[model samples]
Target: MIVTISDNNKNKTIEIKEKKLISTILSESGFSFSMPCGGKHICGKCKVFAKGNLSEPSLKEQSLLQHESKSDIRFACMTYVLGDTEIKLINKETEILTDGYFSQYDLNPSGINYGFAVDIGTTTVAVYGYDLKEGILMCKDSFLNPQSIYGTDVISRIQSSIDGNSKELQNVISDKIQKSILRLCDEYQININLVDNIVITGNTTMLYLLLNKNVRPLASAPFLIDDFLGRDVTASQCGFTHLNNANIYLPRTMSSFIGSDITCSVLAARDLIDDSKSTLLVDIGTNGEMTLFHNNQMLCCSTAAGPAFEGVGITMGVMAESGAINKVYLENNNIMYTTIKDKKPIGICGSGLVDSLAVFLSLGYIDESGYINIDKGEYITEYNGKHAISISDSGNSITQADVRAAQLAKAAICAGIYSLLNEVSLKPSDVDRLIIAGGFGSYIDVKNAAIIRMIPEELATKSIVVGNAAGAGASMILLSEKCRIENEETAKKAEIVDLSTSPYFMEKFVDCIMF
Candidate 1:
């Protein structure tokens, strides 16, 4: 069977061996479709238009499309193909951030002249090439992780792994990383063979999915990791023979949820380790992992913030890509905003989401009690027959459900922050510095974040956006043995706090749901 994806006056066709759901076929075709609810038919983001013989939509599909009259539109994950069909993709071309790599650590060249520092994030994968001989960063690149087709968050991927899709997940990540390495080498006009080492960092679940390890332990309560420590392997060991002799060094993971990304982040952010003052380090991705440093002791916790921040669950959420509204404010009684590249607005990203909510609250369009004055707001617009607030000139808007998702995500992160502070007998004012890491954290307006109460107001001015600390720390380990040793020691010293078992955390989480 042949399936076609038509978008922007272009069509690309791919052949399928057998009858299958459009979502499965699309995934096989290497397109990163957003399945925010892990293809459970809960999220309608994967809706596509069909033009040929196909099975009838299920009751779930009918309910999802009850308000619409177009019979051609159906959920891709729920629609099964009976014959050849042409599928019109509703989602735009995914744009990923390629820049914004920063680190405060001093460079220390090692025996390897060329190497790769990789950050295997749940939603994206970024790589940095290092010229160890000259102690400089040579090239950097990033793209959406292909494994996103299976699921956006780690738990979904873990379920897929346990369901016997581990090999496929492993292959996708491996291929992308190898291609990134080759792409870097080609861009710099260097031989791929010259790259001698690769250092890796990610959440424990991401690392497990990459290595094709058993994720059954993480699928339930008492999340146990038999061996979460970092390992040294070769390119061939992980099935990437293209880079023959490159050594793959994975940083040590802190706990089942608190992974190596936090460990690497701790290495990159020196402010978190200062003894003279207390500090908070937050890497807000799908998993909002944070660390608190005080008097040479570190405390860490992880929260399931979901994929809303990375543009996965919301109505028109997107990554920090071209055409994505990344900032929003009011100028002279008119709403003003900025996109990633000043291009046409397609959707709002994490930064824009926070900014929009903050602006709405300031303008009285939304109340501090989480009520939207939908009937009276000037920016009020209709989206899919529902009331929405416009954030772009293209009629793209945020629905009430989208705001609720943001509330849940923000609440989780905020709850984690306060819960940690409460455990240390410190208040928000006591925090000397709050370092925000990760792709979303880096691009977010700190003041906007504070206004939304996703972050504390007291630490807003003290907040610093250290772009991709995990990736930077990965580069540090790739270039210097000193960094690797120091990171290992730091991971051992850090303590993981289980928020699930804390009544105080639950109470804080409930209280933080409001604006």
Candidate 2:
């Protein structure tokens, strides 16, 4: 059988002798397809347009596709290609956050010709290329992490690794990074052999997965790691054979959950970590990692916020991409929305979800307890037997379950912030500045976030969005030896607070659940 896949105006055809899932085919074909639920018939996000000799849709697939308007739409994970088939991927160009704010540092290159700094995020991987000799950044690029085909969040990916797919996860991410590096080199007319240094940063699980280490430790109680990876190895050891001469350095992680990304983010925002004022740094996503610097003391915590903000568990949620509703507001007593790039609305992203909840609360469509009062609003509609508010004319709506998911995510993050503040005997108003880092944080509206209680109202005015500080930190480490040493010191100064054992955190979590 022949399988033809089309993505971004590029086509690739492959031949297979037996039947296979479209997701497997796409992965084998080196296509970046996200199966957030690990092909378990959940998430319902692996939709593709295909026509040819394909197996009949399963009952679950039929139910999942009921709301979709296109008859040709099918879940890539559920569909089987039995014969010649052509699949067209709805691969929207994602608006990745790459820029960030960082303190100035002198250039001190560890290598002579070229270097690359990579920030491997749970949802996305950003790569930055530089001219080491002249201390200039040549180009930067990013793509969806290919390991997402196994799952979305770190916990899910860790579970997948424990289930005997460790090497597979490692190879996919390593290959993707290598491909990104080679592409950057080709685009900038740089020599691959001269790329002498590479610095990579990510969460503990991500770095462990990249190294193909034992993930069983992270899957259970008292999650402790035997190797806190602040070591250097050859690029060939990390599967980057093309850059055989390059030295790859992995930054040290602070804890089992709080990895080097937070370390780098803290390093990037060093100016705020002053003795004069208390500063709170937060990176919100599936996993909420935060650090608080107060009175020469540093405290950090990690909370499982789930993938609701990244559109994994929400009913009509999606990533911040073209056609995704990125903002929502009320104008003249009517709800209004705008999409990224002013494109037609497909679904709501994190920022839009927060805004939607705030708007719903203000309009009385949703009570303080999060119950949907559909009859109170003219745009209210029913979705999957639950009251929902329509966002567009094309059947996109936010269900009651989505609101609860957002509430849970927001509560986790908000409670974490308060717990850290409580430990320092400080209030939200006592903090000097709240530094919000990461792609999702960059686009969220501070007012709406506080309106839904996702962030404290007192700190909303004090929030600063620092885009991809981890990437910036990675770049800093790659360029300056002083930053590399400072990052290690920053990791050592952090005191991890285990939230699971904290009754205070539990109290704040319950209280923050209510908007």
Best by lDDT: 2
lDDT of 1 by residue, 1-515 (tens): 87887755646898877789988887776565666676887666677888797898788888877855576898888999888899987645555543443455556745466888898888878888888787677888887787877788898999888888998888888887888889889989867777778888888988887787788888887997897667786676565758776778889998899999888878888644577889999988888999999877899999999989888778888777688888898899788898877888877889899999998888877887677788765799887788888874655688888888999999999999999998889999999888888878887888988888898889899987777788877877887788888888888888888999999989988888888
Candidate 1 runs further than 4 Å off? 2-14, 31-33, 47-75, 85-111, 271-273, 375-377, 392-394
TM-score for all models, in order of appearance: 0.90, 0.98
The CA lDDT of each predicted structure is 0.82, 0.90
Best by TM-score: 2
lDDT tens per residue, model 2, 1-515: 98889998679999999999999899888889888788888899999999999999999998987888887898999999999999999877888999988888889978889999999999999999999878788999999999999999998899899898898898899999999999899989999988999999999999989988899888887998888887797675676657787889999899999999999999888876677899999999898899998999999999999999898888888888899998888899788889999987888889989988999899998888888897885879998887898874645788888888888999999999999999889999999899999999889998999988888999999988888999999999999999999899889888998998999999999998999
Scanning candidate 1 in windows of ten residues, the lowest lDDT window is 93-102
RMSD of each: 3.1, 1.2
- Candidate 2, residue 371: lDDT: 85
Error of 1 at 299 (Å): 0.7
